[model samples]
Target: MSSLPPASFQTPRQIFAAFDRGDLSRESFREAMNEHALQLIEEMEEVHQNPVAAWMEHLRSRRAAGKLGREYGEAMVRELLVALSEVPEFPLARWIWNADRPHLPLYCFLRPKAEPVFRIQKIVCAPFVVMVRVEYGSSEKSATVREKFTFTRDQVGRLRMSGRERVK
Candidate 1:
């Protein structure tokens, strides 16, 4: 009954535009972003090249060409830069950026109208444990978040997070 387009056929930019125009519900947009992020993670895992760096450069070019708004473009660039630096851990980093962050996918929701910037302060990857320290927020307010995750392989041999906790 809804008028929303199929998320599988739309790019993240298209989904964002649809949400901005009131054509897509908030929850739908979130799901679409999740799907897109997952697909990107899978693709990044398969590539041997530095796709993350290429992606960041592409974003910069898009911003330079005025395809994306200034604030939104800058914010995305910052987020992608962090992901690029994270390399083999880029999948988890990208997931955290897109899925773990509550206020993402809707940049206009920030109270003070400042674009958020994301930075990964530390990442320690052990045998079955991952600890990441990240700082993200707008100029007005920011948060340093640390998360620990224990991972294990599933029956199908796909790596999965067995447990996760926000470290205080």
Candidate 2:
């Protein structure tokens, strides 16, 4: 039998790195990431329904062990609640899990050694694309950093975050 959280949790980060290296095509990257995201959301829903399940216990242990970051448990609860109420702008857990690089600005849900507040520097809305410049946060190895998030409207006009890159 396979483990509850599946060792494939790190697959997205590897896929993203492959895309960065031009080893994977953009379409393939999007497809793989979206599939992985759907799987994670399904698991989150399952855990939400059965809070005391074994999978939940495994996740709790991971959080306590700092395998998933300090604020992961709280963030997961918040994400589940928001998901129950409405669709989120982006997959918060996915981003947080993949943000392992020292240079990358820490996700809002994470509490680094020194917590840095985020500010929305700019937002440009267009017909099909929306660009947001966010001052994300500082990490232990880096100073304050800004990131550009690109969201594109789908067929039904729901905006989905497609890309995140460090702002120069």
**Where in model 2 is the C-alpha error above 4 Å?**
1-10, 54-168
Residue lDDT tens for model 1, 1-168: 002123234555557879999999999999988987786675456443656654564454444324323433444433433333333332234323342243553222111211234334454445444444544343333353344544444476434555556665
Model 2 agreement with the true structure over 32-57: per-residue lDDT tens digits: 88888797687567668766764545
C-alpha RMSD by candidate, in order: 15.6, 13.9
Q: Give stretches of model 1 more than 4 Å off.
A: 1-114, 139-146, 155-158
Which has the greatest lDDT? Answer: 2
lDDT of 2 at 109: 32
Whole-model Cα lDDT of every candidate shown, in order: 0.44, 0.49
lDDT of prediction 2: 0.49
